[model samples]
Target: MGPSITDVPKSVLQDVIIKLPTKSIIMCKSVCKTWYSLISDPAFAKLHFAQAEAYPMVRPVDRRSVSRNLYLVEPEDSSGFDLKDHDCNRSRVHMNLSKYKLPVCHPEELLNYHRNGIVMPSHETERKVSMKITQIDDNNNEVDLGDGFAFMMQYDHNSYNLVNSCNGLLCLSYFFGNRPAAVCNPITGEFINLPHGPKHEKAMTLIGSGLGFSPRTNEYKVMRILKEQTPDTNKVAEIHTLGTGSWKSVGTARCSDSELSFPTCVKGMLYWFCDKWSGCSVISFDLDTEEFQSVPSLPFEDGYDVSMGDLGGSLCLCKVESFEINVWVMNDSGPQKLWMKKISIHTGFSRSWPRGVYIPMKYFENDGLLMFNSRLNAFFYHHPGNHSPFIYLKLREIKYSSSEAISHVPSFISLKDILVGKDVEILNINSRCAVLKLPGETEALSLVEENASF
Candidate 1:
């Protein structure tokens, strides 16, 4: 008789299971009692987690292949690279769900189905293109509300807007007219309009806002710091919770007009850089507790503007000087001690003073690297630093023009046709649910196989 199949060494089995796709791992849980026991080991799970974490959440090199030419910029040297050519390429490359090999269903699918296959836009739009949406569902077909959904928030042509997404909801605010705000679940096509607050005269000011979810209560909240007209008063911070339907005030003592920047939300709290004429501090607001606290000044010399972002899972403060950028990652205060690492800056542009430029750091799920840039009009897919040695996306050539008027120019790039690259891989996974890729497999090939049966 042939040898029993179960004779494989435990070490060999572990290696095989670890290399399998996540879906396959779940399937192997039912293969046999031994296999199931091996797969369910906490130590094995931790090893897999460490392996996954080793890869960069967002590979800086991968940004090179991302398509950056979405708008038509009208530069002086318009050597036949006009709007028509750009539109033609956009139409040709516009993502089609049936064309990619996605492992999981997209949240957009459920959102569209709820709306008769129409994804709702935050702003009114006449331009319509056919795009498929996919909803994420568990084994039981229930929605996964922890990972947030992504969707479009439309605004006027020349407006500044800021968006911070957390826990399946997005907080969107526009910096034109009354500075309207809204909370939207792109996956559910459900959005609640926020009450417009008092208007401000300064149109060029940066409006800081963030969205966060409270797991304890399952409630969502939005926070904004607007420049108050009465700069001398201490009423600059404002907050709005999803269920409350209106803006509320957070009373922090006012600092000098030039010292306040938009707040960055981390760990259920909103933080902002505060340089009161007396000293520099980081002001934080705990949304759940409704309490305010302040952290000591960042480790840096004077005269540098500090910005906050998420690095790995911790909060990081970035200080940029001429041709140099210093990033400090805050660590545990006791056991490990506070560890700060410096990322040498290669971008040569003089560190411009923090203005109303809405730079929101987006943490990619693939790797742990934090991604963002200073260009407001550029889409999130493009890299903005000059040291990257990649072709610059000419904004003039790719700028969007109104179909009706020859000279009607818009302020912001219309992202109606833009596709988040993350969605492509996700949809591929949902459809197959168990396809394993070898180490050297190309993304394009994986995408091709993902869409083969769809």
Candidate 2:
């Protein structure tokens, strides 16, 4: 045999390990103590997270489902595309949320419980909601979570209506700020519940919310735009850091009263569309300095439904006309000329087409496919020159009404590592469906191979 891996130099070994994906890195930990020490380093986690590719996390658009499951969208050949059936082309890796029960706490109920100050769930009862997660392949066959892989969560939210994914953590909350938000790593099953913000004196309308990470400070922040129903109809912003447990006023939000759209976080900036007297312009907020700036305005005409998304790390604007959809990508430049129309999909008002504004979700770089979602259905479009340019793939609607998809990158960083001294609930589920309380530093990952082949 050749030289052993242990014979390699420390510097060379690290360079190779950091380049591997998160699942493989975890497996390397059990190989030996040296590998474990290297992979477990906090610095290595950050480096690996920065290099990981993002995948789309698809879920039910309608939040009425009693049991919501997270789906990983994978692309297949055009042969699976069917005009009659919507669930033929794509395969999903289901992360079942039905097994775990979310602790229900509405905003009003939590306010009343604050008379004696809100108390966290006791440690003895924290293990009540342990759950087992299984992976289903493209052939619809059930498989184990994987070797040395497990998933668990100690949930503490009523509903996951408002979801903002950044880095490797998901910011889950109820729409209109009806409940406290929880920052959770679905892959690791570790979560921290944020304290509710101060109650506003005047009635406030939630315009939009975003979760972003600041690499400069190595901190994650949540920003909320609330429009006070006052005479001026002015908008103000509030920000909450992960471990702070309180929100501070962040001055005014510069945006007019357009229809509310979900914000997208790219790099360290959060962007959303806002109506202007001239037309509609994109507004961006920097997570590091906590400053807001206006991006170059779009050149499109008014009176069309618009949405924002991140395509290949650049800001993409999706405009939906009567039946056609145009996806424009903007290079990070100072002028407006950098914005170019990337994908133009013309789906005539056919009988099979869902009649609603389509929102551009994610763009598959290697496959040259762009995915769009609407209130009623979801469609995947391959750029010109590919077989079957326009294909519709609707999610199986057994229990849920509609579905929504967003891009998410999984990270191996533990919440306890970031929020030191804070009490984080750890839930562990093995391949046998056994529930146990693992140590804080323990890692449990479920591997799902992402395929976007033609």
Candidate 3:
């Protein structure tokens, strides 16, 4: 025998497993049954995720925690990654990335601003909805997420929305069975359905919804806005707290004819661009208080094509004013302060909206550079306001869809750990090899329990 069964102390063993990264933990699962049990414990994943937060940037995280500031491009074929942009002299760098898939009606990204490399694609055939996932590494390799079979593998539904993603959790807008929504950890192959709410008449149907995290309370909340689409209708807001499993009325918000914008979380509030007001402007929703507020108007006329985005840990507004794109940041939080215009660049546009537009994607912290990507070009601008004013910048012959591009550092915070599981399944499995299987195939996470050993 290699060693006695009781030779090692259980306390010491516990300490060792919690210190390893996600990759190491996955490989070690196959080493032995005992090791798999320890690493697979939901308690251990929670402990490791919580303790790992204190890790400093100096330590080399060999684990793929996502690139610091990488831009994602979707070629017309929706398969291979392109590298024609590496010849630039800006601080932005390019790597040889491979292909991945987005599971939406449009070839657009399902979630944005959330820092996790995991992406879920849903394919429905003959009435059953199959959940397929892929992980895009820094190497551009599309890896499988975990070792679990299809979720909602057999269900009678045709319509669903890939609602919102924060941390490593995905919020499905569709009501599974009778539930209002389903919150799933695509990484762990574990999902919890939210309790169902009262069905409304056709007049008060749901028009828009979003999810956000409160750093202060350390809780995740889903905000679903229901509207009648009538001229004098008042929009209703329903808030769902993860642990409560119930959606509570957060009071109705008044603003007719306004459309909801993509949700952006900052500090403890959610911001979005909307025409739901007299003028098309940004709106704010508080995470802690569950209240809604309208942000002050940006310094622009009513005719400019404008959008809101998160830049450098703050809320930024981009407007196509005159022949240049004006980049502005909110100097203060909440509904106060004026929009500060910082960078201006001439990109050959006029009063009309161009056939394509450049959306701000990423901001480099180590260096002061901002990058934006459009349908046919990827551009970067260095801040400090001392460089040449929109001169002959570098060009790359890469092709991406006109869809939205997003960038963030991937994190390993488990959805199960964050939302404490009571009747939930905490299977001892790994995410790296829990590959997403094709239609009519059999696989769960990475492997079936009987065949855990590779």
Candidate 4:
């Protein structure tokens, strides 16, 4: 070698390191003190996060208590993370389950089995789905792990629910607003508590909430929807800026439901599934302009269970019909072709549509796989083709009533800087390793058991 990497200039090294994937950058922190200091700098994190891509993020619930652990799924090929703007019309699947047959099981039976911490024998018949999970406990201030691992951050003593994900930051709120909500960077463990929404005289109830980032102003904002107990059942929306430390009245909401569907943030706008007297439609809110608009709804008339999500920077809806699922997407190009059919997945199991079905979460283009979760609190990757195979990833032994994984990009954007003088607590995530064996895999992968916090 002509010269060592250490001999490289600081500016050149920083430039090269920032281009690597988030997992590679995290490993760079251990090279030496100089590299650690350079990588840990706030400026470097901001620059690197800008270039990062969002991946499937899951927080496995621990029935004993709340969990603060986060899992980031990375594909074998880094380019597989590029779910947006790809030209591949077909995909090649990795897990070989051509001979494997999916067992016929209903959603109710799966849910009941999961509730009792029992794994159905049918789910164990095939080992087509597999992932390598590693658990690491870091004494350092930052969370550092090798490939195919998760990011960790500490949370408070109470339990919190993940409202939505925006620009690498997760919006967390207490169940039914028992306590204030917060926005946090799970990687850095820096967060700021938000004040409750504007108080109202007419008994108000929390309906919905979400967090988003404003690209125009470079600010993070939180929104809350409250329904007043009046004859008309009026609803009001409020906005809260991070650094400003206060809430502002936006306007009346058009939704009439006491509890609206979960919201998804895509490209700085928030979208929610709204039920109207006419039919089902999607409502969108702009973080920059502070305006709400109605987007097109699904084509079906009724009796289909649907879940809305942000798939590859576009608004995606997945509806279940018997054993088949329809994936529809709203293109951002123009108004002429608003919603169109993207893909159709046949589960291959001949059974009646259960209470809960497969809901598309995120897509991996290079891998030709679509990642989604079922109401049974498990995640599966679907590869659309003649045979339509699915690979399942196990999150731990924790039992949950329902589970969902959001498209989240891991970043180091600090809340301390975003909130300036506000109280931002830096936390330490507790970590431990467990064992999980797949149906046919030779080697077993480690599972992550993380402590609770938001």
- Identify the candidate with maximal TM-score: 4
Candidate 1: worst-modelled 10 consecutive residues by lDDT: 445-454
Regions of candidate 3 where Cα sits further than 4 Å from its true position: 1-92, 96-164, 174-180, 184-191, 229-231, 276-278, 333-335, 348-357, 366-374, 377-403, 420-454
2 against 3, candidate with superior TM-score:
2
How large an RMSD does model 1 have?
Answer: 16.5
Quantify all predictions' global Cα lDDT against the true fold.
0.39, 0.59, 0.48, 0.59
TM-score, cand. 1:
0.44
In candidate 2, the residue pairs with backbone N, CA or C atoms under 3 Å apart (3 or more residues apart, or in different chains) clash, namely 86-394
Q: Candidate 1 — which residues are off by over 4 angstroms?
A: 1-160, 177-180, 196-208, 225-228, 259-262, 274-281, 301-306, 332-339, 346-370, 376-397, 400-454
Query: Pairs clashing in candidate 4?
Result: 155-453
Q: After superposition, how far is residue 175 of candidate 1 from its true place, in Å?
A: 2.7
Backbone atom clashes (below 3 Å) for every candidate: 39, 1, 16, 1
Q: How would you encode candidate 4's per-residue C-alpha lDDT over 1-454 as one tens digit per residue? A: 6887688899999988887656666678898888999988998888887776666666544323234445566543444432232243223322211110111112233344456665423222332212222211111122233332311111112246777888878788764242236677766645556664554667666777888777888788888887766677877888888877568989988776746665888777888776555567677889999988666656776524778777777878878777677788888787553788887867656553234645565665543545555454555555554232544444544444334566777787667666634554433221111121112222122223221111
Evaluate model 1: give its lDDT. 0.39
Worst 10-residue lDDT window for candidate 4 reads 96-105
Per-residue lDDT for 1-454 in model 3, tens only?
Answer: 7886446676788787555444455567787888777777877666665553211010001111111111222122212212122333222222222222222111222233112444333233233323454433222244554334324322112223455445545555542221235665533545565655545554455555667788867888877777765676777788877766557778886544555655677777777667533456677888987788667775765623666666766788777666677778888854566789866766554443243345554544433344444432334444444333221122232211122334322234455557633554433222322243322222111100111011
